[model samples]
Target: MAYYLGIDGGGTKTYALLTDEYGNVLGKGKSGNGNHQINVDIAANSIREATLSALSEAGLQLEDIRHAYLGLAGADREVDYMILHPIIRNIGFTNYTINCDTMIGLRAGTNHPYGISIICGTGTNSAGRNTQGEDYQCGGFSYMYGDFGGGGSLNIEVFRSVIRAWDGREQPTLLTDLLLQLLGYDAVEVMFNDFQDYGKQVPVDAVRLLFEAAAKEDVVAIEILNHQGVELGKSAVAVVNRLGMANDAFDVVLVGSLLTRGDRGWIRGPIEQALLTVAPHASVVTLTTEPVVGALWSAMEEDGLTISEEVHVRMRSFSDFELIK
Candidate 1:
């Protein structure tokens, strides 16, 4: 009756899951903002809280778990490890492993043990594992580090395009109208004043307007989507080439809100086109399962259990578990 635990700590939220050896989910827990880059104490407390909630729900103590896996955002650089390693150790798990959140996102999208994962949510990043178990990552640091294509980037482009159209620097686009409509303003000038002079921040949900304009065949919006997709695809290609997986048949897993929740073809189509240029045999998989399950699977594997079909079936039955509120 071995029990396993999985925790996924991200910039916005932390999710935890507890399961038996057979993959029947026993309990789930969630909490806020677990990225140590923002606040180490908050991240540590979030992870601890989620873990305890799940354990309590399952009526088990931390020592009763055979293994635990934590897939956490901001766990990339050695500096990040210096901060996170002690936090994880202090959680009282005798057997556990920690990895970047992207790895679990990769696992959630495919059954394969090794492949590429590209995440395009509020921000963008890519990571991959080769058959030899070597790992390579690209573009998770931020825009200054050459990472691009996500909701934030999309909104920036939207504003830029609207400004260009207003200044007669580019052809008029429906993005202007979409933006004005979304912000409850009748004119771009008023919205601009609010943003530039009144210190109003761009709403994250405004990225959806780009998709809406593109759906209506707005050239500027479509071009924005294509540019973002191509950039993200280039990141994936870089990971593939680094891992020497260009000729291999593997899954290129797509994760995050932009990739999973938005209009698929506008962005994903260009990404596929760009990726196919290099890795022709690669298949794109949108992660339908919560990444916490992948962390659980990783823990199960670490405990010397194979991820059999029955286990997968049982896990899939709970695939719709919402990690985000």
Candidate 2:
């Protein structure tokens, strides 16, 4: 019997799925960060370990898989691809494709060829396809490329606001106290010193604390979510307009932990309102299927297999791996 593999190689964690040719999921696996820019050797091992775990669960071996698809964060750059492609190939899949994680989220969001996908995770990105089969992407270059308003970005904003408030450069916010408490520090100065020493290693869960503050109607934290909502919405609209889908009815699928957070619509509300300003007719939805399922769908589509509605339903019903948290 032949099997297919689909992997979502993300910055926070990696998710892998093993499925039959008809799209029934057999097993799932997960591991740590798989973004090559974070650490190539560690990322490769994460992917390999996750894939192996899935195969073991499915009671299959690498040689039993006919095809595989990997959607990897940071795989867009040639250097990233060069580093990842071989690692995936070495896993022994006979046929495979590697694509940016944004693309998989896009595919997972809509069945139509033309639509937009916005991902707001530890990082953020947007992807869309037009009726002419041309694809467009926005804001996947990381914050260094001026991208803003992902969870990681929000985390940065929280610290910045706290620092400003501490120095009296900005209005005092509940975030000042909330962040210091969350980090288990008595003073903002110590958190800043430790953060500078650790760099990107600063705990991103500060954004979650911000979300909690927003839920309690804290003004400053609410404003932070509101600001990120507008930024993310603008990214979606930018891709829609770039693909000339502004006037047409299209799906704008929201993906990732931040955008899909089970909040009282703090972030979702503002993004919808902002999108309405630009593309009033555009429909918005959340990605219900795991991205790796989308990778499997793509692999099946490439092989000229028809995806039945039952398969879609079955794939969507699969649970996310625990390690993804």
Candidate 3:
């Protein structure tokens, strides 16, 4: 008779899921930009809308959820959690577990309950749970300090390479024509001016193009992807080492496009190689589960239960756009 609600709050989007005691999702909702990168008002509204939408779809009231979990980045900052807790608590749900998105991401792929998770999206970070479920994390120092091989990093590197090429400082890259074409900046001078502008950030979607150029054997792009993968691998190794999971046959889950589906095969290969150099026995897992399931599982386990293979199999076979019943 219990209901569980789970939320994965990200910088660009928020996904929420509702399910019955049996782990059959009854409803799901989505919203936008629920991170510190966004304004507090906007983040609150997103959660409100997504929560209500899911509840409405399930024909259930907010009070129906016996427990809830919010898996989000940026909660490491006390102020960030401070900003979110009130809004979530006000929604008529009392028992809730809030944690970093990495926690749920790792749990999503393994019942080991303790593994390293590396997330590479607009940004990059790694987190893990020690044997006691005590958490350890690394590499989210922000774009300026680290976020090595993610969307933002990809964009920045490509843009820098293009400008260098335009100025005759760097060798020609296949990315030259593609970047210009994607931006409609047929002229280098125009591209220069556009880069100086602050509109929509100049480095968006650079990784996808990098993938395309690499597909055509563009040396620069391929090198970049390879470097990105290596960087990601190095970062993952640091986290595993910090948690002492490096030599443990520890489960490593790669999340986000760069780690899982990125076309930079050369890059991902190096990353794995680097990790093995640090921990040869480690096993890496590619999660096919959306992290929301981990959030729900986390909530349910508060009562000493586990997410068995029966539930995992069921969740994997479940379809899209339907309320979890």
Candidate 4:
């Protein structure tokens, strides 16, 4: 029996799955973030570790695999591809197909056939695959250029607001107190040195704390979510319009852990409403999928196998190592 492999490269965690050619489950593994924007060395190591771990769980040597397909988040552009392909090749797989994480999630969530997948986990993105199997994607740029509803953007918004409050230029909110408490300081300035030291620690996630404060209905916090929701809705609209997924099918899917959080309703719900207004033909719902399963579906597609209900259910039923929180 031949074996196939699939990987979902994420910002915080890399998920991998090993399955028989028939899509019967075998083994699964995971590693750290493979997002290029984070740390390239960490990204490569995550893929390598996750691949090797999957192989081991399957009780086979790495060389015994027939094909491996990796769906990584940041490999959309040329520079990202150029850097990733070589590292991936060096890992010594026989056949490897790579694309942005958004594309892979679409394949995973759609049973590896055709449909749209919206990743709304720690970050947010949407991808559509036509009946012909051609893929259309939107969003995944980091916080600087884009990244509306993502963790990074949320963090940036709250942190900047905190600074504004500290400078006496903006109204105070529960965020300032929450953040200061988190840092063991009465005032943000007391820890300015530790805050600016990005080399020692990443401060990007600070905004998530702000989101929590907003969830408490703090005035400043509520405004932050309102603003972020509008922005996120705008980004989602661009994707639905550009890809024409609204008319292709009446359905659009949402993926990612962001939806699992209660506060995300403020952001994602508005995006759905906005999408309907813009793309009245598009039907939106939370995606029910595990991308590891998507990898399996992708592997089957590569081998000219038709994905069916039986296969889809089995793949979706994959049980393995726990997702470490």
Residue-wise lDDT of candidate 4 within 1-325, one digit each (tens)? Answer: 8888888888778988888877766777888898877898999899999988888878987677777778887877789889988889887766878877776666655543666666655666766666666666667665666676566456666766788888898898888887777667777786666678643332555656755886787888878767666766776677666665566554555666555455556666676778777777666666566766776677767876677887777766664546532
Backbone clash pairs for candidate 4 read 72-101, 108-294, 118-255, 120-255, 121-256, 121-257, 155-207
Off by over 4 Å in 2: 59-64, 111-114, 185-202, 323-325
| Clashes within 3 Å, all models in order | 0, 0, 6, 7
What is the C-alpha lDDT profile of model 3 across 135-196, one tens digit per residue?
Answer: 88787777577667678778878888888888999889988888888888788778788667
Cα lDDT for residue 36, model 1? Answer: 95
Candidate achieving the largest lDDT = 1
Q: Per-residue lDDT tens digits of candidate 2, residues 26-64?
A: 878899999988898888988998898999989998888
Candidate 4: list runs displaced more than 4 Å: 33-46, 59-67, 120-124, 163-172, 187-205, 287-289, 317-319, 323-325
Candidate 3, residue 150: how far the Cα is off, in Å: 1.7
Regions of model 1 farther than 4 Å from truth: 319-325
Name the lDDT of candidate 1.
0.87
Against the hidden reference, what TM-scores do the models get? 0.95, 0.84, 0.89, 0.80
Candidate number with greatest TM-score: 1
TM value for model 3: 0.89
By TM-score, how accurate is candidate 2? 0.84
Candidate 3: clashing pairs of residues: 25-324, 25-325, 26-323, 26-324, 27-324, 226-267
Ranking by TM-score: 1, 3, 2, 4
